[model samples]
Target: MLQEVAGIRIPDTQLAKDAADILREHGDNLLWNHSNRVFLFGAVNVRKTKQHYDLELLYVSALFHDLGLTKKFNSPDLRFEVDGANAARSFLQQYQIPDESIRLVWDAIALHTTPGVAEHKEPEVALLFSGVGLDVMGDGFEQFPADYREEIIKAFPRNNFKRDIIPAFYEGFKHKPETTFGNMKEDIVKHFRPNYKNKNFCDCILHSPWTE
Candidate 1:
């Protein structure tokens, strides 16, 4: 609902508006609101760090970061992250966006859950991941002023995010359980599918065919 927060204004370009509409059409309200918060929180961090980034790129990445979780975008065999990334790539290509810019948004969405890696990428990528972390896990939460945090939430109310987000996550990847392997998403699978057994990396190595 907020067009501007902490000196950062939502990109009002037609492309950004279209992107928001696409997310709204395909994603539920939780994701719709969460995506906006991601951009706002990411923007705030950009200012805090005194770093320059393409607002449009960051905005698109934030908006589509959870898109893979939506019913329309979820895939049978791909990681939800990849599904989201591919959706963003296709949308950007439609506007004749350059490959480089598309790649940045794609990577930001795909690597957002990968923790150690995303934090070191391009500013857009790193900041998007940071924003998601702050929103979901409260990572680095203490750094943001309480009033600013209040403003962000007031703009996009969490509305039981603590409990709702779990089901939101589970439903996204539940059908593609194998895709969650070797990632934090495996935990989600295990939580919901009590009998779920994660594929062991060590087991894979031991079973792998080799002459050695």
Candidate 2:
């Protein structure tokens, strides 16, 4: 938890406090949170060390990067970086945050997702992206054959990102258990009944683990 000093100016004190509470509630000494906590400190510490001019705006932006995930929006896809950016913009406007800081907050929030792009522009954005990914990607990660990626993309909503979102990352870490037969729900199971060859299922059971 980085505190605002005499020179630090955090407009919404409650946003700062709520962010702290979210971290404590969800954190469990995980390296992701620990490093994030350090990143927060380092970003702010830059002011003291090098007299960085954007420390306050940077810190405030970092603090609310994930604010969209709050209870305000429950849809799975709505918790993403772009959604979070929109939420930040609205929150700042509601709180009457200065126009000068609005751009800083929006930039950080938008860049938080596309780490590849932020690599050169906003290095700190990449840091925060990793911080959030290290945790979010763990919960819903998954993987499938190359051919299945497009199928997954078609199966989910545009923003849902079945093939690239947090779900895909976590799923990639582990194979599905053998007990669950069929391609997901009952639809795919019945769709391929005409073939009756069962090549897909056989290949899945044979090539996939847990076949013993």
Candidate 3:
């Protein structure tokens, strides 16, 4: 059965189901609920803004956006967002999804953590970022209708998300602190990992081996 929240219908295709199953298998209760909320919030934004988006593609992006935070998907040298995006790309390829759609989904997941720029991308990419922002940081929360927000939260209660999600972020980034040097993920490493040092980008460039 397709679930509808805030008048947006969740896709019920086999690919959608498979994506959900993969998430359920690897994601904890908090991660699963958060993923669903991301989808719902993104859907609501699409409807409220009267934006044209590929709903199924957005659904897949939302579901897989946080996979890199899971133990099953974590990588030692890539940003968690990139790990999650790569996982989504690999999954979609198995089903023969077109290259263009796969790229959109990849960008949507990879750039969900990036602000200002994501909103300028395709509708699905923009909506994914909007949804993630609303769920993770309450950005634009006031723009959503009250009853609709309530319904979405009821369906996927946050369950003390503020306390829980930070550790997940730390765990995902701690292994690849170098990769987060210029991005928001570096903040997590700086705060949680004791004595962690960030490699300065300018210093690296100045000391480059390419000196002629």
Candidate 4:
């Protein structure tokens, strides 16, 4: 049965259930719980705001947004966010979902980690980021009704998220340091991988291979 919090429905379609199963297979308990919370929080926000969005797409986006952080989906070259996005694209393609809907999910997963920009994109994309921010950093968290917030958290306990999530982030991005350039993912490398050095932008400009 689909669960509801604050009048928003949690998707329980077979596709949604299959997606959850995939996450359970590849992700740890912390990630699985966090992903579920992201969906719930996003759904609650959308309902409270009275915005229209494809609930199934939003659920898939939230569930797949962090797949790159799992061993099964981690990429050696792409940013973890992009890795997750590509994985979503490939997965959705199997179901023959419409290209337009697939693109929205792709964008939602790809840009979920980016701040200040995602909230202005498509509604699904915006809500996905909102949920991520709420769950990960407490952004907009206090605005939600306390009882609803408690319901979401109780359904999906955080499980020492603050201490455990960093390692998962590091594991996903450590091998793709270059992909982190110009984004917050770089911060992960800078903090966790001590020897990982960021390429200086000014230095690259001065040493450009092309000189007019």
Query: Which sequence of candidate numbers ranks them by TM-score, best first?
Result: 1, 3, 4, 2
Per-residue lDDT for 38-145 in model 3, tens only?
998988888767877799999999999999988888888888899899999999999999999999999999999998899899998999999999998899988888
- Models, CA RMSD each: 1.0, 16.3, 1.6, 1.6
lDDT of 4 by residue, 49-155 (tens): 78889999999999899998888888778888888899999999989899999999999999998888899999999999999999888999779778989988887
For residue 37, model 1's alpha carbon misses the true position, in angstroms, by: 0.9
Question: Over the stretch 1-212, how does candidate 1's per-residue lDDT look in tens digits?
Answer: 45787567889899999999999899988998888888888889887788878999999999999999988999899999999999999999999999999999999999999998999999999999999999999988999878878888988889999899989999998888999888898988888888998678998888889755
Q: 176 in model 2: Cα distance from truth in Å?
A: 21
Lowest lDDT 10-residue stretch of candidate 4: 1-10
Runs with alpha carbons beyond 4 Å of true place in candidate 3: 210-212
Can you give the TM-score per candidate against the true fold? 0.97, 0.42, 0.94, 0.93
**Order by lDDT, highest first:** 1, 3, 4, 2
Better of 3 and 4 by lDDT: 3
lDDT of the structure predicted as candidate 1: 0.91
What shift in Å separates residue 34 of candidate 4 from its native position after superposition?
0.4
- The C-alpha lDDT values of all candidates are 0.91, 0.43, 0.89, 0.87
